[model samples]
Target: MALITALGPITIDMYLPTFPDIAQDLQVSSHEIELTVSSYLLGLSVAQLFIGPITDRYGRKKPLLFGLGLYLLATISCALAPSFDMLLVSRTLQAFGAAACIVIPRAVIRDHYSTQEAAHALSLLMLIMGLAPVLAPMAGSFLGPIIGWRGLFAVMLVVAVLLIILCIIKLEESLKPENAVKLSAKTISSNYFGLLRHRNFMAFALSGGLGMAGLFSFIASSPTIFITQFGIAPENFGFFFGLNAGGLILGSQISVRMLRKHPSFSVLKIALLLGLGCCAIGLLLTLTGLMNLSLFVICMFFFSACLGVINPNATALALKEQGGRLGVASALMGCMLFLFGTLTSSLVSSWQTGTTLPLFTSLFVCIGISFICGRFVGRA
Candidate 1:
């Protein structure tokens, strides 16, 4: 479950170090290749939008296996892509296939566990998933120089194949027959609309999605900040990136502990305020021209840590009212995440100046707006 969940981050961050390499090799601007990230997120959102309701009707196992099979093919396509256009399309297909992995695990966890137990299980899984992005770029940085950037997709291909085999052998169906939803376009559309109409769900989903926007903004912007702006060596880029990922792990652990003593809603309030604080401070430093590498990394680490706290709580709260249709609810949450991620990632790239101000300002605005919106959740 952890490995599959981590695939999304691995697919994303592992390629960070190779942006310039891929651009040069493909005879395009680095910025052009960055569109692949946006396209992948867009594809991911599109896939989850449907996959959730499909899995709710069918079982977890079948849909997951089929998706993994497609994932393997898409990854291979990425490795063999002959042009930038081919790579972009392949990456989108890759995310579409991968979306099944990301969405199903949440529903699966929600299946057997209720309320608090589900939240804890999610936190534990998140702990493992946190390490994937942490190590991915570090690994990519070394791997890219050896076999070149295309080799990274070959690695993900191997992973997808292994996961397919593992799922076939070890995974079991979790959704109960009684809870099985009807398989129809009309039914799926209705369930999704119902979820959207729920006040608490909207509050948590939007806030969580915006929180993710902050993370994606940082992820998309970091390579440029560290390598291009600060002139850090490409090989060491992952170490700096890992700092923020590590913050996420630490914050997740903290949230897990806090959940023992407080409700998710209580923890969420603190996390939102603290995360916005980190972004605000970073913005101030950036505008003052004092955001050296160390300060920038520090602020981002806290920013990610705050997300670590916010994500699991928000997910738990959003699905707490899922009388059924856990798949639909989970799908909406994950879809919103990448949809927001796609928007934020595009903004970070498009807003690029020679300095860090745009990235900091963007992060501040995302978290600040999310915090305000979160406060309105569950109100009369």
Candidate 2:
């Protein structure tokens, strides 16, 4: 699960330091290179619709293996991509493949664990997973100058192969044959619709999705905001990025400790309030022109830290009601996140003004959505 969660962040973070190089080499605008990132997110979002149902029906191990295999192939394609179009295509494919690695793991955990245990397990997984965002950018910043952007993909290819081998050797099929549903059109549609109608599921999904949107917005706009607007050096980007990730790590650690004592809802409400406060402050600073890079980074760290609390609690709450259809439930949650993330990211990319407006607006909207959904949408 840790490996699966880490893969998406690794794919994104490893290439971030290379964005400038990729733009220069491909002779495209930086915005175009950013489009590749959003395109990957779009592919991940769309693919989850299919991958979730397929995994739910067939079982976790097979689809996971197949997805990792495709991921290996896609990473190689990215490494050898000759043009920006090819890179974009390869990135989309890579994200599609990566989606399985992400969605299936949560379903698998839900399959095997109770709600609190699942939250505990996810917290541990996130602790491991957080290392990718913390370290991959730094590694890429150093390695990209040495091996170029292509080499980063080569490294990802190697990681994919290792993950495949690990899955083949150690992973057991967790979904019982009796629990697997037939993948008929009617059954798929009915199952999805059922989940959609579950108020708690939708509420929790929206809570996590909107919380995540803030992070995605930061990532989509950060390069331009930090390097271009604030004139931070490329190497320093990872340093600051890692600080935000560290905040997430710290928050997750706090969550792990809190889960032993408090109910999930209690933690979630508190975290959401903190997240809303942090984002509101960030936006206020931006509006007042008091938002320097340091202040922005500090605000981001607090907001992301709150997400650590928001995500696990919301996921646990959502899946608690999903008795037998954990896979579809997990997929729906993943889909909402990636879909909203892709949309918001594209909007941010399109509105690239070299100012803080796009970032603040997106953050504000995400927190507002999370607050509204959490307050009104869930069951008592």
Model 1 residue runs over 4 Å out of place are 19-29
Residue 323 lDDT in model 2?
65
The deviation in Å at residue 128 for candidate 1 is: 2.4
Q: How close is candidate 1 to the true structure, as a TM-score?
A: 0.93
For each candidate in turn, give its C-alpha RMSD to the true structure in angstroms: 2.1, 2.0
TM-score of every model versus the real structure: 0.93, 0.93
- The lDDT values for all models are 0.85, 0.85
In terms of lDDT, the poorest run of 10 residues in model 2 is: 371-380
lDDT of 1 by residue, 110-219 (tens): 88777677777778887877899878877887788897889998888888888988999999999888889998889988998888888888888888889878888887
lDDT for each residue of candidate 2 in 216-283, tens digit (9 for 90 to 100):
88877887888899999976777777777788788888999998998787788888888888878887
Question: Which pairs clash (backbone N, Cα, C closer than 3 Å) in model 1?
Answer: none
